[model samples]
Target: MTTTLTRPGALAASGHPLVRPQAARHLTDEQIAELGVELDAIRDDILAKRGATDAAYIRRVIKVQRGLEFAGRGALLFGRNKAAWIAGTTMLSFAKILENMEIGHNVLHGQWDWMRDPDIHSTTWEWDFVTPARSWQHTHNDLHHRWTNVVGKDRDVGYNLLRMDADQPWKPFNLGNPLYNAMLAPVFEWGIALYDLELPEYNEGLKSKADLKRDLKAVGIKAVKQFTKDYAATPAVAMLTGSGKQALYGTLVANAVRNVWAHAVIFCGHFPDGTDTFTEENVEGETRGDWYVRQMIGSANISGSKLMHLMTGNLSHQVEHHCFPDLPSNRYAEVAVRVREICLRYGLPYTTGPLPKQVASTWAKVFKLALPGKGHFRKGKPASA
Candidate 1:
């Protein structure tokens, strides 16, 4: 949750405060309006270009994913050679990652809404993940975006597992073994499914029993379909062709690869050094510009080549993505340059680094924050409802 280089009170060398002071009180109206205008210009420019090229890009990515998936599964089902199986599984893994990231995540974010394709829109496009699209949209798009890294508000802080912040009360089980973090990456989707259920909230009387039952039924139906597709039906079909074992193993490997990659990329975005977390008091009366500032500070960027960007769903520009979630993701890179300039203009922190550095710094925070310590940025008392 906090940044690198241990200092008693400072977050980074800049010593920038984690959450901006209450923006309405600290910022001049003119300054806030200037930021709003600059960001809007960037969004407007990207919006104007979201036509043929963008459409072609999404359609092409989907086509490649489909082709790879078919070829991969075909090899797994019909081929007996071990090398063929490995190739098939690798292809399948890439296919799943592309589907989940470039296709599923963006489409469900309404990134392609300008296409006017009803089927591909956020309202109807479900994902391959066990968490139902509607539920995920509510939790992720609505809640997570609305409360990026506000410790008590965003359920994503440590995902209700590890203690991400020093202020978060440490329970006996808070001291999880490193293996616990390791195990989570491969089965990240399952962890998300359980988190989405909000069962713990239901138990704590935060969510009603009736709503819990409804959400549970929805999750159960989606989980059944996902499990059957990867674990049962494909293997069964391959068994009829005498390649059942290979098919099953291939599917398992593919799923694990997809899950771990997604987990790693997502963790890199939020938990790394330089990213900030807020308290309820700081966000009170937050304006549009204030929200943008919060997101900018709370998200970190991973720098890499275009292929790495594609693999990360262009979340390498996490700050830009958080700023403009509904924009065609391809435009994030273009807008990122403008965003960084805006940060410099406003004297805001621009936090970014290579993917390896980002990931290592994030995991180090995960390990360091796991044990007891004075929580970073714990001064603001949580605002009342």
Candidate 2:
């Protein structure tokens, strides 16, 4: 199914303030309300069906991830050998990816909270990333998710660093967007840790000095633990086995691979060519339906095999994730189908593409926005299934 933009008021009649006459397809307020109801039903249906299968799926993935990490570390002890180094690095890379993406990310989202298990619960699950879990939840789940792509409202728009949207005032610092992003990718976890600190908020007097100090302390603790585990403790053990340097390098490369992959996946989700950025005024009087519409238009998806989807924590279904973020990641594939159908019926855009294409499009936008200009990237066309 496909949809296209219509002229302002071409199909709308409900004069709802939330209805953007300039939208890709003009939906009447009544239609938007109906869309919201359908989406709500999808959420309800998934919640109802959540059961032992979902529980088992998460448990199985966790077991595999743990086993891979154990084996990778074991292999690193023999890393003085060329084959051992390659094997350990490869396994460790996959381990870190699985842990960060499939397990840690979803667990932190509270996807398994329904089970009432404290071990895998969102409040207790500290992810492998450098950012403290609580800080990330505050900035990400609380702020970024609520704001999505609203220019100044969502800090994730450019993480307060890059000129991602033309609406974002251009500064001389923005000319370094490409370079900043290049550096950010390999150290993405570190970047996220710094971003979660919300330094800009502190500087602007929105955050209190005491709170910033507390958050900084938490980040310091988390960073120290991560560094010790990856760079110190593991390598120290391998040192006793005469493979200290090899083990250190293996962990270093594995972390870099995970960071780069994570950066790419996340960038593909929200910064791609077709995804829209909103203004604060656009969400001033937002309703349930309006919020759904915003998420649908503000995010893009990656189309690929199930493996690719799993690796991305099912964020390949970026549109669906933005809509029903608390739902289990394992269910996003099914949710995406219903969501796409809804988009077709309502003449909304469902922006999606392969990973490479999305990455190129996102980077292109970064470069384009870096220069001083009023030109905005063209709105995304509806993706065909």
Candidate 3:
């Protein structure tokens, strides 16, 4: 959406066309159109090839995740034993992570809709998170993806909490930036649930009170179901076997681990060095080519093994995911090769690094932006494919 350029130096600091003239000078209008064409071809190729193999991949993930959850919960019934507690917690953590990252997130993105399986379809899959899938799709898929890194437009820039970008006016509350992020990591799902309610929109009169109430009701109902399953029901079953306290603690720890992992993967993909933030001015009169270019520069990737990629829901290929959000997550590695080639040909930055480096860079940004100043994060350097 178009927003008026109101923040002082918003354009200049954006490092985009209006912000920094030399930043993106390599791409002319004709070149951007050509880049879009190449990217479109990649997306189309994947779409055409989506078949039994892709379907099998998601099904296998679902089966494994469900099995782990069952084993974990069964183990938790005897969680009074030290070994059982450890095993249960570990299995539960993996199960929750796999469900949220690979199954829930991708399914809700409509990546598997082509399979025509209603049970796994985006409209039906309620993820293992606090936020309702529909609310997340509205805020994440519809808004955040559409706006990417644009200041004021993408609420995810700071999740309406921390001051992630210098363009965001610092407030006394921002003094807690580092602390806030640390705390947020353990309860990221709750934070996202509240964010998905769009409270700011309600305050600004953009959403009616009735609508806010409706959203709150949805969240409340979902929260009850989640709490009942994890806390009440599981612990009650354990109580019959005399391990209620242990089961409760196990589930709590498992959820925290999943939350922290999700937080780190998401931050690395978005806040790491080299990813660009834009001003609304950059998007005005934008074309398909310009949009494609924005996704390339606005996102970053994590370089690692197949297992790391799988754990991150293939979001380690963040650049590719943003370029083609609807494409199957299993195919991101192949897509990354072509995407990197296109970036090289276009002289665009393909920002990426190992997990540790990206996590450190993103955390450094959080600490730096906590204070009030015209501080700038380091620009991203081109990464090797």
- Winning candidate number (lDDT): 3
Residue-level lDDT of model 3, residues 202-266, one tens digit each, is: 99999999999999999999999999999999999999989999999999999999999999999
Judging by lDDT, tell me the better candidate of 1 and 2: 2
Instruction: State residue 100's C-alpha deviation in candidate 3, in Å.
Output: 0.5
Model 3 residue runs over 4 Å out of place are: 1-22, 378-385
Clashes of 1: 0
lDDT, candidates in the order shown: 0.80, 0.85, 0.86
Candidate 3 residue 231 C-alpha distance from true site, Å: 0.2
Considering lDDT, where higher is better, how would the candidates rank from best to worst?
3, 2, 1
- As a whole number from 0 to 100, the lDDT of residue 258 in candidate 3 is 98
Give the TM-score comparing model 1 with the true structure, all chains together: 0.90
Stretches off by above 4 angstroms in model 1 are 1-29, 375-385
Per-model TM-score versus the true fold: 0.90, 0.93, 0.93
Give the Cα error of residue 365 in candidate 3, in Å.
0.4
Worst 10 residues of 1 by lDDT: 1-10
Per-residue lDDT tens digits for candidate 2, residues 113-140, read 8899888889788889999988988888
Q: What stretches of model 2 exceed 4 Å from their correct place?
A: 1-16, 19-21, 378-385
